[model samples]
Target: MTPMLLVMVAIGGTDILFALDSIPAIFGLTQNVYLVFTATAFSLLGLRQLYFLIDGLLDRLIYLSYGLAAILGFIGVKLVLHALHENNVPFINNGQPVDVVEIGTGVSLAVIIGVLAVTVLASLTSARGKAQNAVAAARRHAAEYLDMAKDPIRRADIFGKLLAEQAKIRALPEKYRAQIREEQELMALLHRAHAEHGSTSAR
Candidate 1:
């Protein structure tokens, strides 16, 4: 078989699996053949678009498969319960023969909606948190570089004023602060000597 044919087969097979669970869940709703056909066809028509939508959000949609699997599994369970309820076997305790399908379908629909809401909320929260963290990190790194640049002389003095205007972004404790101060002092001493030698040469 050609590669394209194989791909088509795989996609079709997956849709069939999704339908196996969903069809039964729908049947559990209205036993009418026409309504089931109409509903299933309409749903399947829109379902194809989901693949393209998911492709656009490949990495960000990590939890999508999990959500889909859970929904499918729920439908499968409902089908099994419905089948068991219909079975009038004597071995089974003759507890009230309840029509489990409608109850199962209602419960499954609610769970699917709840899961989607939580997933969307969590994704938005995490994205906002990450963006804030990145902005803060960039500001901190900028401050560190400015501090490093402000060393040694008259030319460096301009940078010193800029650093003072901006509050220290890094909250290094006493020990590191003391070390940076010492480095600044050494740079000042070197500049002072250079200035004195230049002045003497002018004389």
Candidate 2:
């Protein structure tokens, strides 16, 4: 199959897996079937909007993966504790319910929200995150400038953004700046964009 078809297939498979994985989390939060159905439906429907909303900010959210992992881990532990509390196995805890603390839904929601808030705050404030965002934005703007080379007006705007990002990168720590310079592909893209912009300006 074509590359685009392959990409579509891969994305479809991933979405299916994501949906399946989320079902447990939904049930863990609430057992109401109607709520679960609506939640799943809306999540699926909002996937496109969600993608657009975070596409530019994804690189900036450096701690997002860690936060998500923490959330999932907390939920997993909560589920296990819940299972232990309702234990009915013949050999496990003598088939009696264990006296374990079950996490309340309200507490779980608060922890999830709090963890997300802190994660976003930390990511946006860290020096490393700032450097990474600058590098990513510069790279993206350079590519966009190249793609819009024929459109002088649009290219001008993108080039301006690219230069701004480059300035940010330069103002970063020497180590971070060195890392960006070491990226040969990115450097090449930036150089080509600059050359094209200069040529266009002279015309």
Candidate 3:
């Protein structure tokens, strides 16, 4: 398949998985069908805008996966606990409800919010996050510069951003810098962008 087609397929698959995962999580939070439907609708509608808003900062959020995992785990545990509390299976709890403490909605909300807050703070403040952000920014800007080669004004702006990211990468410690898997490729791309920009300006 073509690259565009592949991208479309990947996006469609991701959306499907997201809907499947999120609906159950929402149900875990509350069994209110109306609220779940509205929440899912709004999330799907706003997902594109949300992605664009945070696109540049995504690489900086190194701890985001961990936070999401924690949240999902919490929700799973809560669901299990609620199921046990309402259990009626003859084999389990002797056909009676398990007296396990169920997590409240307020507490669940607070825990989710707290985990998100801490994850963002840690990702933004950590050295590794900074390194990853710088590398990602450099790559993004380099690609932008090349794609906007016809637009001198925008190309120059992108080149400027690329240069700033390059500086950040240089300032990082050797240990962190060494972690860049494609440093040579990135540098070559940057050099090509610079050469192209110079040639365009000279014209």
Query: Best-fitting candidate, measured by TM-score?
Result: 2
Return whichever of 2 and 3 wins on lDDT. 2
**Model 1 lDDT tens row, 83-194:** 6777676666575455554345556668878877766556445543333333333333334433443343633453344344223313444454354456564335435544
Off by over 4 Å in 1: 1-18, 25-31, 43-48, 94-107, 127-203
1-203: candidate 3 lDDT, tens digit per residue: 68999998887676666666699779767989999998887776666566666776577899999999999999999999999999999999899999999999899899999999999989888998889889888888988889884677878788888889988988998898787745788878888888987888798
Clashing pairs in 3: none
lDDT of 2 by residue, 1-203 (tens): 79999998887776666677788888778878999988887776666466666777678898999998999999999989999999999799999999999999999999999999999999888888898889889988998888884678888888899999999888999998888889999999999999988888898
Please, what is the TM-score per model? 0.44, 0.89, 0.85
lDDT of 3: 0.85
Question: Candidate 3, after superposition: displacement of residue 168 in Å?
Answer: 0.9
Let me know the TM-score candidate 3 reaches against the reference structure: 0.85
Checking candidate 1 for backbone clashes, the offending pairs are none
Report RMSD for candidate 1.
15.4
Clashes of 1: 0
lDDT of each prediction vs. the true structure? 0.55, 0.86, 0.85
What is the TM-score of candidate 2? 0.89
Give per-residue lDDT, candidate 1, residue 126.
59
